[model samples]
Target chain A: MPIIAAQGLTMRFPRVTALDRLDVSVEAGVVGLVGANGAGKSTLIKILLGLLPPTEGRASVLGLDIAREGAAIRERVGFMPEYDCLPPDVSATEFVVHMARMCGLPPPAARERAADVLRHVGLYEERYRPIGGYSTGMKQKVKLAQALVHDPQLVFLDEPTNGLDPAGRDEMLALIRRIGSEFGISVLVTSHLLGELERVCDHVVIIDGGKLLRSQAVESFTAVSGVLTVEVQDGRDALGEHLHAQGVAVRPEGRVLVVDIAGERTYDLIRDGVADLGLHLVRLEQRRHHIEDVFTS
Target chain B: MSTSTIHDIGYRRYDGPRLGRGYLVRSLYVHNVRAVWGLGRPARAKVMPFLLAAVMVAPAFMDVGAVLLTDRAEVLMRYSAYAIYLQVVVSIFVASQAPVLASRELRFHVVPLYFSRPIAPLPFVLAKFAAMVTALLTMTAVPVVVLYVGGLIAKVPHPLTHLREFLLALVGCALFALVIGALGMAVAVLTPRRGFGVAAVIAVFLLSSAVVLLVQNIAEFRTNFSLAGNAGYFAPFNLVDIVQVRLLGAERTAEAVPDGFISGVLALLLCAALVGGAVAVLYRRFRKAGLS
Candidate 1:
């Protein structure tokens, strides 16, 4: 069963319609929410967390009805907000431990679990320091620690890579990937950068202007074989003519000639063509697409 | 589900302060305290109450010498510190106390953080009010002690009666602190900007006093109809002052339930109303800002 499912979910802000009749479902594993700013990613997560009431929709997280069972859903699920909220005065250990206790962990257990989660989030050395003194990266780790201290079944990370430098961003992304793969925790992570999500997410949910543009496995995003890219050093026009004469689909793409391999034997024909033209084939490979490629067409 | 995983810390289903089967109130309260402590300025955390103590004591020391000069210096000694001088101290002390309690939070933008935690907005408001009151008590108690000892060194009248009055003064100070602190906190809650909070507090205090002063002049020069005659008696905080004054049976200047008590009562009622209204406003604001 899908761990999270939404059908025709629409979220309306005062001057904006955040999510427009969007439908999405994720069974388990890490799913990435990718979109530009104002793309309704945060709205969807807030609604799921029971923080915001949707304007129009039906949704569920872990089989709990979002509208009626929000408290229950929130109780079982964890969320990491995008902003810098950690009070600079208190230590991470104290804050996370308190959160664990609030989540209903008894005193002793709250303390122990708080310690474990802080270490897990890579704040072991600075757990006792006031959050005010933490680097941005450390603060992000504290936010994550609080979410995980109670051991929720699923976690929602909103723009987790935001505001980090390249190196910090890479480390955060790696840690996120491990959360899903190593700890076996289900994650719903949002990011505007499709390439970053492509690396860590099992499923990718693309949204644009508060609408579901696409939703599919990560493989569907990176896999494409419909268009063929061919390179030739000489007789590029003749090669195109020959390919057209032979009824193979062909188009000129700048210096290289792009073709549609009409049959399985087209590779052999292309090789022969290359030999006939005495053109050294610089490179020949199936065209693999990036997530950005889908954005174009 | 009742059993624990090997990696589990093995906590039994928490039956310990069932804060409730599922009420979100307790969670909100827990979250606010956690967030406050988590922000981690321990020195400031401790300093707030300590500074509040200073504000409460500052004014009472001015009265200590006069009390020691009197024939009833013992009465001044025992009563001056906590009760008799408490109103005088707090009336002026609240000027600074109101801003620190209300405005500082506004300056920090920690309001959204408080609202967004897994807690209700009301608890955040309540905890802040509580913190301020605790600070007030600390600031007031020390002056009461100093005046009591100062009066003893120059004993004149019944020392034991002074002690009884001092105890009453403590009660008076506590109630006074609650009403004023609640009012200040409510003003802070209304505006997320510290400057606005401070301005609101000063405006409310100054306006209330101005209105009372206008009424006093009307009663003295133009109309014999005192606010006492018009029913707009300007004494809300008088009850605390009443007990403090009443303890001095001989030295008392006016009735315990004077216009100030009426004014104090109105202030208290205004505080309660403000807390309710502010919480409702904050609930809407928090939801809109995505705090919860």
Candidate 2:
């Protein structure tokens, strides 16, 4: 069964419709919801977290209705918001312990869990200091620690790499992947960077303008599209004309011949045709469809 | 040294008993109450609340000392009038700390963190309200207790009478705490910036009182005691004193006194209206802000 399923979920603001009829289903893995800034990624996460009610349609998480079981859903789901929400006056230990306690852990157990999560997030020796004194990387770790201290079944991390430097972004992505694979917790992480998601996410869901453009496994997203780009040291136009004469769809893209694989013997035909024309083959590689192709194609 | 083996302490799911929503609400209440006194905060954060508390109790202690030194029990202040007597300190406290309680979460955008948990928006608002009311209650009631004990130790006549007045003063303290806490929190929640929130709350208290006092002075010049007396309802401090005098049978001070029991009833109704109106406004405010 899917961990989360939305059916025609729509959320409308006064001046804008943040989410419009969004339909998605997510299984247990590190699923990346990829979108630009105003693409309703946060709105969908908020709806799934039961923080905002949709203007129309229904949504469910863990087989529970979002509208009716909002409290129950929140009880089992943890959320690391996109913006900075930590209280600056309190130490990380105090804040995480307080969050743990809010999640229904008793005082002693809350403190123990807080310490454990802080350590797990690689925050040591600095956990006792006030959060306001810490750097941005440290603050993001604190936010992640508080989200995990309660040991939720599923966690929604909104832009976990937001406001992080390159190194910090790498570390945060690694931590998110570990939470999904090692911890066996279902994660719904959102990011606009498709390259990073390709490295960490098992599945990617792309949304644009409050609509789901594509949702598939990460492997399928990067699979070869059967289009091969062939480059010759000499006579690139001659190669394209030869492939075209042989009833193959060929076009010249800059200094190379972009050949569509017409049949089962397309690769052999290309090699034979290049040799027959006495043209040296500089490069012949099959091109895979990029995740960015969803926008242009 | 033996090699340390890697322990696979992967994230463990919380299968232990999940407490109910009541626990979340109670935790918020405790957290906000501690925040009001600057507990678990920097030393500078602790200064204002503690200094105000000390300033509040010092007068009671000095009243006790003067009674002891001169052997005059009449110098001891009345317990029921403590809220009226220390109105400025209480106002300052409400102005400063209510922003700490009410606006800090909104200013820092931490309110969504709370609502995203197992708690509802109304409970979140209620918890803060309850915490502010409790903190204000402690501030007002503690000084009244000090005065009661001081008066008793100074050996004023009728100890039972003093106890009765002490109980009545506690009731007045509760009313003061509710009205002031509600008003301060309501004002503070309107503005997210702490400086603006603080200034707004102080203006609500001082400006409203000054306006009422000025109107009453004008009414007194015209010998209109009814109009001057009824003007007390516009001032929160005097309104509480009027309740104490009429409903609890405390002595009326030299300031505005109600014309009759009906006027006192009207003042009490207005107090109720103010508290209810503030709570209603706060409920809507938090509910809307939580969504946003």
Candidate 3:
């Protein structure tokens, strides 16, 4: 069964329709929900977690009815919120251990698990220090740690890297990637930055104004630009001419040749042509369309 | 990959009203840790009632010797209601904030994080009340010990009187907190905004007190104050005055301790009704928030 499935989900807020008629299904991998603020990413996550009552439609997580078995579902899932919420005076070790206990872990087990998860999230040495005293990066780590302490099956991270600096963002991202890959936890992570999600997410779901724009694997997310930039050390103009002579559109892009091979057999043609030219092809890469294309469209 | 693997890390048991103990206790821990000397990251959060007690009571310790030497020592030596006093405040604050609690969690980004797992919305509300009560209960003890010990050092007379007050104070404090807590929580569940809920609560408190007195004062009865069960409704708010009447055993007021006891019971029932309503509303709101 799919880990999560939603059919015609809708959520209405006082000010805006936070989620429209959206449909989604997931089968256990790190899926990134990419959207701007108020795009209904948080709303969708809540519905799956059985936190929000949808205005319309039905949803299920881990093969359970989201409406009826919400508590059952939540017990198995983990969540890292976007804002700073850890108590300033409490140590990360104490907070996470407490969370683990709440998740039904016995005292000894909760402590052991809390310690392990905090260490895993990169708060190893500083776990003993009060979370309030910790840096932003450290606080983020504690949040992540508490979510993982109970060994949940899936984790929903709402803009996990929201307020961090560039370096902190990268570290948080790395930890997220590890959560999905190393810890074997399925993640439904959301972010405004599509590029960041692209690097780590196995699958991507894009939304705008609470509506789905596209949902596809990372491979399908990247669109092939019209022009493939080709570079050769000795034959640049000659290569452009050779390709042009063969009815392939080729334009000189400085020292490289931008070729238009718009066919499934383009790779074959490029290979054969390069072998025929008696020249080394240093670079033969298709220009990737930026994520902004989806927004612009 | 395997079905067994899925079940290993999943929530398969489906049941009704499985209260989430984790969230209930964790909420308390969060409140406790947050308020206990202001210890976590979200540093700006106050844990208000805890701080309030410390601020209100700390200065009283400085003049312990002087107070012991004076006649006013009786009030200080009356009883250790430190726990009761703190609990009352905590209960009041908790009740006042209930309506705003759900909204705050949503606003502060804690709701989604809280929801992502098998956490039910009802637990958060219940847990919050419990946390506030427990936190209030925990902090109330410190001041009692401080005051009690301070009295000894100062050699105050009738130390037993203070101990009696302390004992009664626990009962008084619990009744006070529970009564106010139930009402505040109900109001909190009904409201959405923190400020609105808080303001509403303050208004309720001020208004309730005014109305209670207004009714008592203006009513042309055979007598204004009654020592019977009919007078039970007004006892909690009028506790100090009731204590003055009952303990002093005046002729006009009932000389029986049972009269005082009955009043406490009736007030407790009122609190229960309010708290029960508050919990029910929030729980429903939580379910709606979680499931469509």
The best candidate in terms of lDDT: 2
Tens digit per residue, CA lDDT, model 3, B1-292? 3224423443222122323565455745565335433444334445554456666456446445557666355545333334323333544555444443445544334444555554456666677666545544444444555666777766667777656655565554454455555556556545666777776666665565545555555442435445333343543344432433344322222112235545545444555666687678767765554333
| Candidate 2 lDDT, B229-273, residue by residue in tens | 888888888888788888888887536777677776877898889
Error of 1 at B123 (Å): 3.3
Better of 2 and 3 by TM-score: 2
Evaluate every candidate with DockQ and list the scores: 0.20, 0.48, 0.22
Predicted candidate 3 versus true structure: per-residue lDDT over A125-175, tens digit per residue: 677776657888788878888888788788888888877999899878877
Question: Residue-wise lDDT of candidate 1 within B1-292, one digit each (tens)?
Answer: 2112212532222233313333344444444433323223466554543455566566556567776656455345344334333444454444445555444534434444333334544454555556556555555666766776776676746778767766666665575566556555556556656566656666665565456556655665654644433323343243334434433332332222334345445544554565466456544544444443
**TM-score order of candidates, top first:** 2, 1, 3
Best by DockQ: 2
What TM-score quantifies how close candidate 2 is to the native fold?
A: 0.91
Residue B286's lDDT in candidate 2: 77
The CAPRI classification for model 2 reads as acceptable
Q: Given candidate 3, what's the lDDT at residue B241? A: 28
TM-score of chain A, every prediction, order shown: 0.84, 0.85, 0.85
lDDT values for all models: 0.65, 0.86, 0.65
Evaluated on the second chain alone, the candidates' TM-scores are 0.60, 0.94, 0.66
